[model samples]
Structures are given as C-alpha cells and as structure tokens.
Target: MIASTSASATIVEFTTSHGNFTVNLHDETTPITVSNFLKYINDGDYDNTVIHRVVPDFVMQAGGFEFTGNFPLTAIATDSTIQNEPVYSNVRGTIAMAKVSGNENSATSQWFVNVTDNSAGAPALDTTNGGFTVFGEIIAGMDNVDTITELSLCGTTPMPDYTAEQCSDSTFVPGTENFVTIETVTIIDSTVDTASSLNSVKNTLLSTATPVTPTPTPSSSSSGSIAWLGLFFTGLIALRRRFR
Candidate 1:
C-alpha cells in the first residue's frame, strides 16, 4: 500500500490496509522528483495499488505493481520518466525513487522506503544506482512502516506474473493473506507563514549582508582637531535630528 519518501512540509498521507502514515515531500530540494511523484498523485494512479514488494529490515516498495481483477499483477501506467534528483541520502524513513540498473533517469512510478539506513559504502547510495532520488520523508505513523516491513512474505507461492528476472522483490507480500492497500494519498500544505517573521529575518539578513563598520576616531595627539571634528559631527547630527 505504500512505498517511500521530504521539505516545505507537503505532508502526503497514505491510508493503507495496515494503517495510515504521513510523509512531507521535499519540494525545494528535490523539485523534479516531487513534481513527477505528484503527477502520479494527481492522476490517482497510486490509489488501490498494493505494496507488492517488502524486504524485511531493508525497504518496502510500491507504485509499480498493481494487483487488480482476480487480484493479479498488472503493469501500472506511467507518464514520461523524470530525471533523478537524489538530493537526500537513502537513510531510514526517506523515500527514494526506484529505477532499473544503469538508467539514472528511468524513475517513473515505482518508489521505495528505507526500512533500515541504507546509507553506507564509499560514496554510499548518494552516488550509487544513478543516485536514488529522495523526494519525501515519513513524518508520522512509523508503526505502519514497521507493520509493513515485518510482514510475512509469500515465499514460493505468490510470484505475481513477472519473471524472476524482471522483478527483484517478487516474493514480497504485505502480510499473510493481506496486502497493504493505499486507499489514497493527499498533500497537506504546512508552509510556515513567514510574512510576519520575514521582517526580522530580512533585518538580520541585511545586517549580515552589510556590517556596521565603526568610523575611526582621531587620536588625542591632535586634541584640538579631534574636538573640532566631534563638534562638527555633533552639529550635523543635531541638524539631522531636527529634520526628523
């Protein structure tokens, strides 16, 4: 019923058979990935789809294999594939786009979530598999993630239709006799109202952009001159203040 994910707090809720979980899409960081995923959401293509593949303690994936009509596997339709935007690491709870080997920009509909932190190796998943794009992150209902990950697999009984070569996680089942079903996925705009706070932030940024460099005062070696300069500036200040 779910696969996995984000930044502006676009909370995407996934109501599944096991339970409901929420993810916030990282719209600013991974724009291409988020836009692509949202296309599927807007089309309602992911609704009723089963969480077909589950690798215990690794990841739980969906959005590609659809179980319908006699409850069989049917290839889900997808729009044009999107470029890989793997900005975030494949850490636990982050959802990354799934793609075939060697094809970096082949990510279409399929996605996965890290049950465990898969961020290891020399370059790690950040530079591996054409960089799996992490577009969102689970914000709530981690219990549902646990429930999906710990589910029993079909083992040798349920192979879904595709050949072993085509699908890698074919043996995965959501649970015994029960597959996780994603009822619907909706986005929640949790954008912070910065209109009021921006005034302070703008002032801070302005101060940072240009520091207040103090004007150097003349030394006492020329006490008379220094006093005259100070008096002149004081008069100027008084005049300026009078204008105000």
Candidate 2:
C-alpha cells in the first residue's frame, strides 16, 4: 500500500467479500460525520450490515439499520446533527448520508453511494431543501460498487414515488432486495498496524502495488588496473634513478 498524503486524515481500507475499497476520510472537514462512521466501525456494528438498497445511478444505502426487516431501535439516529459539509460536490464515487426531504437534522447511520456524478448535490445543500452530507471520497476500488449495481433485485426494488407535501419515511424499506447482502464489513486502521514497525509488510500487499527490485553494481576489479599502473610507475622511477 502507498503512504497517504497530507490531505488524507486516515486511510480506511474496507475488506469486503465483493472487493476491498480504500476510502480517505476528511475528518478535518467533517469530524462528527467521520466520528459517527468510525463509531460503527469501532463497535463492530457494521460487520454484517447488508447493502439493503441499491438504486442504479443513484446510491447504495447500507449500515446495520434495517437488515431483512429487522431494525435496531437503540441505534441512535443522530443525537445532534452536524451542519452539512458538502464542500466537495456529490460526484460519482462519493460516500454521503441519506436523509428525508423536510428533515435535515435526521441523518442516522444509514448512507448512500452515488452511482452517477450528481452535479446538483455538490458542496452545498439544495437551496430548496437541506441536502445530504458529503463526507468522504472513494479513492480506490470502485469496481465493487459496479458489482453492487449489477446485482439482482426484487420487491419495491426501484425508487418510491413520494407525492408533494408527503412526509417521506427515511426508514421505509421496499419488499425488494436490490443488491447482494454484505456478509461483513471490516474497517482496518492501517496506521496502528505500523506502530510497532516490527510487523513486516506482506508480500501480497506489496506485490499488488509495485515491485521494487534491487539493482546490481560492478565490483572493484577495474581498480586493480590502476594499482598495477601505480606499481609500474614506481618501478620506472626506481630504474630511472639508477640509470641517472
């Protein structure tokens, strides 16, 4: 794995059955948002969380909220909602929270994945309404997302039609199962893995990135000719002195 640059707060490598995606968390811009996500990661709450909803060209929603009709009520929706930090536009490969239409302060653990580049949802909330919070960006492994997009779906599988002035139920789960249920989500903190500096980097991880080979240089055999020349010069000087 390559070293993270200064812009990245922490490189979060998610090992999923589909594939691994390494996302860079903008902790500085969205501290609470990042912390909320990290809470689920730290508590092992997202291990078996299923990607319950997948709207092609929209977003993939997940986070142990409603798995196969089971909802965790104790799971705090959001004790205190943080101001929306959408400075970075909600483009493709961005990870943002999912919220209801009228309620801006109700983003819970559930989030969505942006399939297409949504220009309207960038950096700021829609003036007509409070938009989703754009916290982290997907740096690598978007193929996993593509695979989720192409999964088989069943039941209210598509977007629900909400009438005007209708209160949207954020927790509403259509009978359909859109994408493959995520077996497990493991959030690895790679920094701590390097704390001891004793654990050697695995060859598999290194081989995935780039292979570094050692270069071979010529030995000092060429210098022996110079030594011989110096000895000959000394012998010539001795002979010259004797002849003189």
Candidate 3:
C-alpha cells in the first residue's frame, strides 16, 4: 500500500511467499506517489497480486492486477498515471511504479522491483523514454529478491517486452516456479513503533544460536567401559603371574 505524504519514512512490512521484507518509504521526494500507493495498501488493494512479469536480473512487476487475479483491460479502469518522480534512480532493490504506453502519469496500482540498477533505463522526460517512479527501497530480505531474480524467466534476455499484468504461460528459464507473489503488504508506521528492533534481535539470535550436534554421553560411557575392561585384564594378568 502507498502511504500518506505525512507518513514518517516508515518501515513498511511486506510478508511475501518468499519471505518478509522491510522497506523504507521515500515519502519526501514522492509524496503524492507514495500517498496514492499507501491508499491502496490501506484499502487492502495489493494483497494477492501476482508478480506477472519477471525479467531475470532486471525487475519483477505486480500490484496492478486485481486481488482475484485479473488485470484491468481498459486504461481508464486503472487509476490515473502518476507523473514522473525521477529523483530516485532505478537502483537495485528500489520499488518503481509501472505505466502504460503514452501515459507516464497513469501509474496507478502496478509497481515493479528493480532487481538490478538500471539507472540508464530511468524514465526520461523526453518522448523516447518512460521514467519509472521510484518511491521506496527494500531495506531487508534482499536475498528473497535475488532468489526471485535468479529464477527462470520467460525471456532469453534479462529485459523483455513482456509488460502484461500476469504472465502465467510465460515459462521460467529453468522451468521452475520462481515467480514472486504478494501474500500480503502492510504499511508499518515506524514513528508509532520501531518493529525493526525485533528483526535485529532475531538476526542476532539466528547468528549466535548453538549448532545442532549430538551429545557425547554414549561415547564417554563406552570409553569408561573400555578402561574398566583393561583394568580387569591387567588384574587377571597379575593374578596369573602370582600363581606362576
């Protein structure tokens, strides 16, 4: 969901099928864009949206499609396209809004995750380029994005002309189901409570946890039995010597 312009550079939480990601929204530069986006998020609009287009090492797009898995056919049905907020480049892990041909301001619901830094591909003001609006960036769980980027895409090249809402027929490079789906998108106002503190603790615990290993109790008992057996053998030998 998009957030209000007044929102703190809040840490938004997206619980995806792959994993959870905390994104820091860039509300300062793109207030209107962010507000529009957070509106749908607050309204539960982006939930269950399929990552319809997957350009490996490039970007994965979603959010324009319906919650029921259908994309709007008419241009008017989708919200008005937003003007280019190109202050932020198409850097890796940045979230940018997607728009149709000839309508840069018409970016309503759909957005894309830039898997790689495509600063050269940043939407330009001239007619030749379509500048993608970068509103926020992924703060955590980039491994999930990397995993999705490495997944098989429908195209041979990393950048393809496939701009549809959903690409079910499009095959992955390795024919694997690596498509990213939005299980749920939640706007977390960091000003209210810093939830990322818990994430840091969790990461620390994961890093310092005890390794999984079997205890050596049985091995110690066997060694003790062997020692007793050796002592018994030595005593018998001494007894035999005495008898001799």
Candidate 4:
C-alpha cells in the first residue's frame, strides 16, 4: 500500500530495499512541482519501482520500471505531466523530475537523485531537457543514493538505450535480481504543535525551537578547487609581505 503525503512533505521518507532515506520537499519554493510529485506518491505510482538508469557519480535514477518478483514491468499509468518548474539547482543529493531529451513537459513519475554537483549536466537537463524540475533534496539516505549509483551494470557501455517504460527481459538486471528498488515512499510529519496551537490556555513559558537543518554533501571537485584557491591566495599574500 502507498503511504500518505498528507503531512508536511518536507520530511518524506523512502523505505527502500537498500535502506530508509528521507527527502525534504521544497514545497514552499516549488509548489506546483511538489504538488505533482505528491499525487504520484498518494496514488502509489512509485511503489516497487527499480532504479533503471544508473549514471555513476552523476545520478541514481528510478521511478520508471516496476517489478513483480525478479521480472521487470512498466509503472502504472501516470498522471499528466506538470509544467516545467526549474527554480532549484541540480546540486548533489537533490531529487529532480526526469524527461526525455527533446520533450520539456513530458515528465511523469520518473525522477533522479543527483550524486554529485551536476552543474556540468545542467545544460542538458535545464537548457536542453526543458529544465528538469528540482523540487526536493535528500535530507537522509544519501548514502543509499550513493550505493545505488555504484550498483553493477547490466549491460556494456551506453546501457543499450533501454528506455521503454519496462522491460521483462533479463536486460534490465542482467546477472542477478539485485538492482536497487524503492520499496515504499511515505511522508512523515515532523511538525510539533505548540501548546498555544493545541489549546488557548498557556501556563508555561514557550521557547521557539530551532528548525533542524540537514547537512549538505560537499561538492567534491568544485569545493576542493575553491579551497586550493584560498590557500594559494593566502600564500601569495604572505610571500609578497615578506619580500617587501
């Protein structure tokens, strides 16, 4: 059964065959995109789906192929595609809707988890692929996302161009029935109702609790370059002052 997306979708939980991970929806930022995604969640469209396409160090894609036992199948009929809402950047751990190369508003259910700062691929997704809607980020289970990205390949380089909803052939998961599966998607409420909201009577002093922020994964190559540049500038300043 599909779980409810009724609560604050910001703390959406995904119980996968691999492990549990959570995503924080940008509901405030991308309302329409988040709404569309919630519809899929509500209808159980993504249940039992497999990570069909794995682009190492780039993305861990799923929500396309479904399965019964070891056999692969296409997902149930999807709702109409939502308009492009490309407000957020495709940085690491961010989850974005997927679409074909030429079509812009063709996304319906398929999505990807970016394993790296995909700014280099932004042009293909944003400028070329009609800006893949980035509506959420993985607040937890990013390690699971990383694991999915490192799964064994079923085919040789280029992956056989196998994009036809679902394939029953052993082509999808070649050697074993071990491809990563998104077992379940559930939205858990993390909101704390204050005494005031609960009852008009207040007896004790209430302190506003700070919101918990998820630690973001560093952009390896880019962040490292910036660190190196800072060190270089610091050394340059020290050498110039000593010589003077």
Candidate 5:
C-alpha cells in the first residue's frame, strides 16, 4: 500500500475512506520524526488503519490501531520510541506525533492532524509535553481533512460519513464500513526538502520535575487504547498519559 515516486520524493499521499490528502514531510528540520513516520509507511504499518481518535476543533489521530473486522481495535506493532524533535509549531493542518503525557521522546507510531491552530488554541501544543513534534503539513486536499473532522463520533470512534440519525439509531449495527479507514499511503513526490516557516519554535513548557501520573477515573480506559471517555478530557488526560 506504499509506493515511491520516481522524482525527488518528500510528499506522501494518504488515501482514506472520505478522500485523499498529501503531506509534505519536514525532512530536514525533523529528520528523526520524518524517518520514523516513513519506516511505518514503508512497512505497511499504516495501511487499513482507522482514524481512531477525532475531537472536533482539536485533532484527528491515527496510525496506532487497525481494524480486523472486530471491536477493540488492534494496536499496531511499534519500534523503539524515537527522540523528541520539537522544532516546528503545531499549527492548523500540521501533522504531529501523539505520545505519552510528559514523555517527550515517547512517540512511536500514533500521529494526529491539527484541525485547529493547536499552538495558539486551548491546548497550546507548543507548550505541552515537550511540544508535540510537528513534522509535516498538509499541502493539498485539506478540504478532505476538514470533512473527516466533521464526521460524527460513535462513542470515541469517528464514524465516517455516518449521519447523526444513523448514529442515533438503536438498530444500527456498526461495521468496518462505518469507520474512517486509511486505504493506502503512497509517496507522490520526493522533491520537497525544506521545513516550514513555523520551525525553530522552542518548547518552554517542558518540566524537569518528575511526571506525576493522574489517577485514572473509573471511566478511564487503559492508556494507548482507543476507548476514550470524553472529547477534550481524553485529549488532555489520556493522551497525556498513554494515548500513544
């Protein structure tokens, strides 16, 4: 499901159930993060994966779990965690890695797209957890990403194109068709090699004190799993702990 272009290659196209979008990787500025992403793509680790987390006006996340025709999504196999590369800002349309709360270098495979300007928004990602590593930006098909964000949530999972009526129907039986699936990811162009203008923004919110794990609410699902409890709550609490 992953292929390279003959030309200078740096852009990757994601074909999803809703549509397609292309991302220009920050190969020079965030080499470690970019290389980590490409390894998962080349290994076919992202194929058939579902965008398991969607918070309206926040972030739409994927690359952590895959659907195998069942409930409780399967966690994708991960390599060792990569070093933190917080060189860029988490602005709108940018893509960043999701990691355990307080651990700057804990990013493995899970990633999220900023639906809003997270750097200046409620979750000032630039100041959180050594700053979420922004490694790429959506170059084209941002409308598709916007459409995906508008999809309604069924519990914590976003149901692609499923209407509110359909989601509210008690008789509705959710299936793989209901989930937003990443069909294929191909390297469209590789010529691009520059970082965004938003690069070099240092993270000043990283704390040297030991990280204190928050008490898990009774409703809290285990960290790294897709069963989120609420919207911003999970985005803040779970993602901070083990959402990756």
Candidate 6:
C-alpha cells in the first residue's frame, strides 16, 4: 500500500519487504533535495517500487522502477531533475541521489543508501559525479538494510524473496514477491532534529581533511552474517543514467 506524506515531515519511516526503517532528513542543510524527495513521497511516486540495484558492501538503490505483475519493470514517472546539492558526505547508512554519469543535476526520483563508507576511497562518492547528494541517514532498522544486501542477485538486480533454487533456474519468472518492495513510506515525526546533532566533520564534505570513519557500531536489529564480498566499484559507476 502507498503511504501518504505530511507537509512538515522530517522523520520518515520506510516499510519494505525485508523490514521497516526510519530516516532523518537533513532538511536544514539540503532543503532543495529534501523538498524534491518529499514531493515524490507526497505524490505516491514511490509506491510499490523495487530496490532494483544492490552492490554488496557499497549501496542499495531504488525509487526508479516499479513492477506491476510484469517481467520488465516499468520506470516510475519522474519530475524535473533538481540542482546538485552535495552538502553531506556519503557514509554508512546515508541516503543519496543517483544521477547520470557526467551530469550533476539530473537526479529526479532515484536514490541509494550507502551500505558502507564510500566517502573517501577510490570511488569516493563525495568526489564522484559532483558528489552524490546525501540528504538523509538511517536512524533505525539499518539491520534490515544489511539483510536486504545478503539476498542473491539476478544479474545486477537483487531478488529478496527468491530462494537459492529459483535464483539459479533459467526459466524462473519473478512475480511481485521476488523484488524488495517499499510497501509504504510515511512521515512519523516532525519534531525530531537528528540531522542537527550530527558532527560537523561527518555530516559535511566541505572540509579539506579526510572525514573520520566512525567506529563500526551495530544498531539494534538483525545483524547481517555474510562477509563482505569483493567490492564491485564499477557497479557504482554504472548507476549513471541519462534521465530524459
């Protein structure tokens, strides 16, 4: 079921196939990006969407396509692309916008969550593609995000409900249950200001010195057991799409 959005919402909850999670928007710092995201939520543009791409240990992307009992997923209708607002660093649990390879302002409705710290490495998200716009961070249910990453992949797409047998079968046709669907995204709080309390160095990439990587702390939820697979950096680069 599609969720409704509140005009003054800052903390939003996402109920997905794996589980539920909440995010605190950096509305004060990235107002434009926040407003753009809220517009999609308000219009129900993200309803029943699939988390189409998952690069293990890197990111899980969604909000671009939907499956309506079809083989090939349909692209969600997008609004006009918003301007680049690369204010925050792309760290673990942070959500950012995805855009075309060479374009910085082409982001419309597609967004990805950084499963690991991709802020300062070779494919540093902070310095790549004019830096992916980090607009929100997970405040709860990150374990659900980690759990979604462990699902077997059918090509570049992640199949949340497919069994090991079905994933390997060539003739297997995925129905609505095969994808990690965002069942609903509703505003839960408007009073909390989690983004305001974030450390300056960790929140902003405008600093010259390398951002400090926070100690790996497991949040309260089901902990993922799969070891990090070989990092697929190219998968991050291929996310570039020329939205028309």
Which digits, one per residue and each the tens of the lDDT, describe model 2 over residues 1-244? 1222222234566665566776666565566677666665665666655554444555666663424443221132333444554434556777776554445555556666666664342212222124456667676788888776665432212222322222133344333232244454445543422223322111122112222221222112221211211101122111111100
Per-model C-alpha lDDT, please? 0.56, 0.45, 0.49, 0.54, 0.69, 0.70
Error of 3 at 155 (Å): 6.5
Q: Of 1 and 6, which scores higher on lDDT? A: 6
Model 6, 74-119: lDDT tens digits are: 7789888888888888889999888765566778888888899887
Query: Candidate 3 lDDT, tens digit per residue, 1-244?
Result: 3444444435678787667777776665677777777776766777765454444555666675422322221111344455666556666777877654444465677777766655442222112124556777788988876765554443311112332322333231211123355678876664533423332111112223333221212111222211111101122111111100
**Residue lDDT tens for model 4, 1-244:** 1233554455578887767788877766666777777778877877777666555666666776665544334445766766777766677778887764445566677777767766433223333344557777776789876765555444211122233222224233432244466778887844422111221111111122222222223232332222211101122111111100
Judging by TM-score against the true structure, name the best candidate. Answer: 6
How do the residues 152-209 of candidate 1 rate in per-residue lDDT, one tens digit apiece? Answer: 4443112223333322343332232344677788766646232122111001122122
lDDT of 4 at 183: 78
> What is the alpha-carbon lDDT of model 5 when measured against the actual structure?
0.69
The candidate with the higher lDDT, 2 or 3, is 3
Report how far residue 19 has shifted in candidate 2, in Å. 2.4
Candidate 1 steric clashes: 10
Model 4 steric clash pairs: none
Displacement of residue 173 (Cα, Å) in model 4 is 8.8
- What is the lDDT, from 0 to 100, of the residue 88 in candidate 2? 49
> How much is 231 displaced in model 1, in angstroms?
78
Highest lDDT, which number?
Answer: 6
Better of 4 and 6 by TM-score: 6
